[model samples]
Target chain A: MDTAVLAGEIMQRSGAETYRVEDTMSHIMRKSHATRIETSAFTTMLLVSLQEEGRQPLTVVRRVHKRGMNLDRIVHVNEISRKLCGDSLSLEEAYAELKAIEQESQKLYRPITYQAATLLTVIGFAVFFGGTWLDIIGGGIVGAVLVGINLLGKKLRFNNVFQDISASIGIALMGIILKQYVFWNMNLETVIISGIMPLVPGIAITNAVRDTLMGDYLSGAARILEAFMQAAAVAVGIGVGIVIASALIGEKVLL
Target chain B: MILKIIGVFIAIVAYSVIIETPRRFLWLSGLVSAVGGAVFVVCNEAWRMDMVLASFWSALGIALLSHIFARAFRAPVTLFLVAGILPTVPGAGMYRTVYYLILGDASMSSFYLTQTLEVAGVIALAIFLMDSVSRIFLKRDVGTQPWTKERNMDKKQEEK
Candidate 1:
């Protein structure tokens, strides 16, 4: 029962779909010779129960906070669960592995590497959008600004929607400055769009679709609404940035 | 076109890193995204298809390939599908919708709003169709796998 809840918590925190978490938890509990097992997962909570013939029913509820995209952790947990269910791993070993995965302190990439990757991603998006050399360079610069904003937000403990809005505002301001002052002919659309790609709710929307198809309507609706809210936040931030820039620059520079 | 596809692959790989995908599967995710981007490029640029249609085709291609790769690699399907489908997601449409709204053009805003919903809907449809199709095959494959055979027998015994 403990292992099942731990596994479910890690999977949910790592942003696995609701059904996957439920399925994994129930599967793990079944291995304990329980006559009945029940698992339920929502976007932010997990409940699992196990009942044996002559023993009291055991139940666990874990509230998950601070969700992020960490496919590496999800893959690790999936592998451990698979091995455990396949009878290749002992329960103690499986519990140990789950604990390690939950408390992993090692960073996957260096700070500099993460910043550079963000730069590269935005630059690549600019190129994919058919940007010229100037646009790519401008996009990279805006991407760097975004990275800086994110780091600062982390230090300040900004909430998720606030983080996204601040990042989009930074992208918009940087794009305008680059186009107006640094690169005279750079395409603002390319730079702004590419820079905002990192802040998009693509993964969230996709996950919502997957969850809904898996017959988990509660989390699915929550996620879909979450995605739209994030998108609106980004859009509103950009709009504010544009208005601020125009007022400061003494012209309506953008529509 | 080649340049754009390469760019999409690079972006996808970098995005996967940002999301902390396992190192071993980074290239696989990149490959999947590039293929989907290629399809969108061909359908949109070469054939002048509508953006909604292009995105649907791209998402369908990504979903199919991600399912195949997930089965082949024994990894969760979302590990590949989430990042791979990034390029086709309707971020631009959503942006445009709000952009026009802020500009006080209610008509254009509504138009893009509908377009964004359509694109999102088609993408969901594509994923749903592929998921159902893949599950049928996945069931047969898992039933035959030796590792799951024991579990299957246990289930059968429980039923009896």
Candidate 2:
């Protein structure tokens, strides 16, 4: 029971889909002598109950917070559970493995590498959208600035919506500044779109679709709403930046 | 077109880093994403498909590839599926939806909003179909269903 709950907790906090979380937990619990196992996972909480013929029913509930994408951890937990079910690992060994996975999931990438990845992602998007060399350079500069803001925002523990809004505003403002003063022929649209790619909720939207199809209606709807709010925040930020820039320059920029 | 494929590969790899996908599988995931992007571009430009239809085809390819990779690597399908589907996600439409909304152009906003939802719907259908078909054919190996033979063995063991 404990092992199942632990696996579910790790998977939930790591942003596994709700059905997958329930499935994993149930799979782990089935290895025990429990005759009946029931597990249900929501976006914010997980519940597991197991019953044996002669023993008291066991129920565990875990509240999931701080959901983030960590596919590595999900894969690790899946492997550990599979091993446990296959009888290759004892209960203690499985528990220990889960603990190790929890720790490893908390490990952060090097700050420099993370920043560089952000820059590269923007450049890639600019090129994918058929931007010119100048646009790629401009997008990279904007991406670097956005990465700095994100790092700072994480340090300050800013609200997610607020952080997205501010970062997007920075992106749009930089794009306009580069177009007006730095690079005469740079395409502001390509640069701004590329810079904001990292802020988009692509994962959330994909997960939401999967969840709904898997019959987890509650989680699916919640994730869709979350994606909408995030996109709106970014749009508002870009609009604000464009409005401000246009006011300063006394020329309307059609966005 | 080749540059776009390369860009898709780099973008997916960079995203894998952010999502902390296992390092060993990063290259494979990038390849899957690039293939999806290539399909999307072909459907959109070469075949002159609608945006929503193009997204559907791309998502179908990605989900199918993810399932294949999952079976080969003995890993969860979500690892590759989430990253590979990035290119087909309606981020641009979402941006346009909100952009027109803020600009007070309700007609444009509504158009993009519908486009976004339609794209999301088609992507969902593609994934659903892949999952259902895989579950039917690979019922014994996939281990997604609870009533598989392995679970029955546990029940039998408990009975004894």
Candidate 3:
């Protein structure tokens, strides 16, 4: 039961779907000779109960306060549970594996590699949107600035909304500066859009759709609200950036 | 078109890294995302389909591929589905909605907002259909086993 709850907690906190969480917990519980297993998962909590024959019901509840997207952790937990269910792993081994996964999820990526990935994402989006070579260069520079802001925001532990807004404002300002002083014909719209791609809530929206479709109405609604808030933050960020850029440049770029 | 596909692959790979997808499955996720993007481009640009409908088809294709990969790799579908569907998501529409709203153009803002919601709804429907169909097939396959039925009966009794 403890192992089952631990697995469920890791999956839930890592932003796996609620149904998947329940399924994994119950599967793990079944391996313990439990006659009955009941598992319920929410966006913020996990409840699991295992009843063996004639004893008492063992219940465990874990409250998940912070949720982030870490699919690597989810896949790890899934694999561990599958092995446990197949009788390949002992209970203690499963526990140790889950603990390791928890730690791995907390580890941060290398700063340089993360920054490079951000740059590539921005440039890729710019090219995908039909931006020219200059747009790609402008987008890369803007993306680098955004990455710096994100690293700073992480160190400062800023709220997600504030982080997105500030990064976007930085991107817009950098785009304007590039257009005026560096590249005369750089497309600010493409640069700004590509820079903001990392901030968009694509995963949240997709998860919301899946949750709602799977009949997990509560989590589905919660995820939808989460996506909406994220999108609103990005929009507010870019809007503020655009306004500030226009004010500083003394030109109406909106028209 | 080739550049767009390559761009989609690169962008999805970067996104997979950001989300911390398992290293083994990163390339598969990127490939699935590239397929979705190609389908979207074909549907929206070549066929001139409406944006919402195009998003629906693209999302549908991604979900199907996700299921296939999930079964093949013994991993969860979300491993591929989340990153793969990024290309068809209404990120641009959401931005445009807010952009128009900031510009004080209510009509355009509402227009983009509706488009975003419609695309979201269609994506939901596509995933829902895939989930239901897969469940049905899985049930049929498992139903042929006597022990599986016995387990289901046991579960029903326990629930009662």
Candidate 4:
């Protein structure tokens, strides 16, 4: 609830060096102590931080804070703890910071649900290289449908399983458009790659790999498995459409 | 040739940075990606090393650079991993894959499989090896996280 307590939670999640936690705590303490800042409050602070810092890369700031070995602003933060904290503070640790924010009991924009639907429709056209009116209109519809689902999930407070399933199905439906409408000219690979861009396992896999390298074997393995599952889910979404197309055409769906 | 390698490396690094990777290893990953491709190409063409060996060496080089970058940056291995591996995605090979698929040449099936797997393998290899090795020398100094002692203590109890 207080700054020190808040600092610990941050440390646990972000794996920041002790000093970094203390610095954040001190900063927050100097500012607010209501256990969690409102979304607007946090965003306001972040904007101020960003503006004052002149748009530096987030990671650069982190790295500088990391090398400050003289940084432990608290006790019981012996060398071992300090080392672990340092280990956790890496860029991969960025996730930890995010986790902290999410746990703040206060959140940002309401997932911008409608925005997602709009994005999907726009992306659909981008996938198709649309110059024709039909192309633009179709992409808009798809995007709208996609965003509709995103909003639906938020409204219903759907769990991860439900979200994943709907997203997968939504993607397949788009694939149907790719097939039935565009047919022979659909640029299947590009469509698949671009549509599944959000599902790309780059970040998860990289983190898993990093965790393992850092000797956090248990965490690493868990993360790697998580990454694979995410990727497999993406593949399945595409594979289903491919299989369906193959069945309809009596030819192996090479996409 | 040198510029090409550097260009690829720069591309990979730029991608990572734009997507919000840690700055500490951005340059390092870029260097690795560029150099890794160059090394493979050079070894394959000039030294006449077996293609497999040349690629292996390249992967090894990139992986090593990635690992060291991870350590120095006090970040995770992926910043380095993506930066190191993206350059080697085998766009050319994939082009060939598409061509062969369109051409319906069954023999090129293995070629497609081989090249596709190679690219994936390089990426996997970089991440897997980097993950495995990063553990040996992990740093944990996070800059901003919910790191209050009481909160972590409570979390430990919940986990148990």
Residue lDDT tens for model 1, A24-84: 7877776777788889999988888888999999888888987988898888888888788
Candidate number achieving the greatest TM-score relative to the actual structure: 1
Fnat scores for every prediction: 0.70, 0.64, 0.66, 0.06
**lDDT per residue (tens digit) for residues B39-136 in model 2:** 99899989999999999999999999998888778777888998898888776786677567766899999999999889988987888888888777
Residues A1-255, model 4: lDDT tens digits: 232333444342333322334344334322321233221111001111221233432211122111101111122222223334334433234334434543655222234532652354245323322223443444444445556676788799876445655655575567555556565455444433334443345555555555555455655676567665755555454445455555676564454
Q: Which is the leading candidate under DockQ?
A: 1
Q: In every candidate, how many clashes are there?
A: 0, 0, 0, 44
RMSD of each candidate relative to the true structure: 2.1, 2.2, 3.3, 14.1
**Which residue pairs does candidate 2 place in steric collision?**
none
Candidate 3 lDDT tens digits, A95-210: 99888777763444665777788888888888877788999899889989988999999999998789888887788778877887899888777777888888888888878877
DockQ for model 4 equals 0.09
Q: What is the interface RMSD of each candidate, in Å?
A: 2.1, 1.9, 2.7, 11.0
Q: What is the lDDT of candidate 2?
A: 0.85
Model 4 stretches with alpha carbons more than 4 Å out: A1-148, A158-162, A182-184, A243-255, B1-120, B127-160
lDDT of each: 0.86, 0.85, 0.82, 0.46
- Tens-digit lDDT track of model 3 for B36-151: 99999899899999999999999889988887777677677889998898877777787788678777899999999999889877887888887777666654452322235447
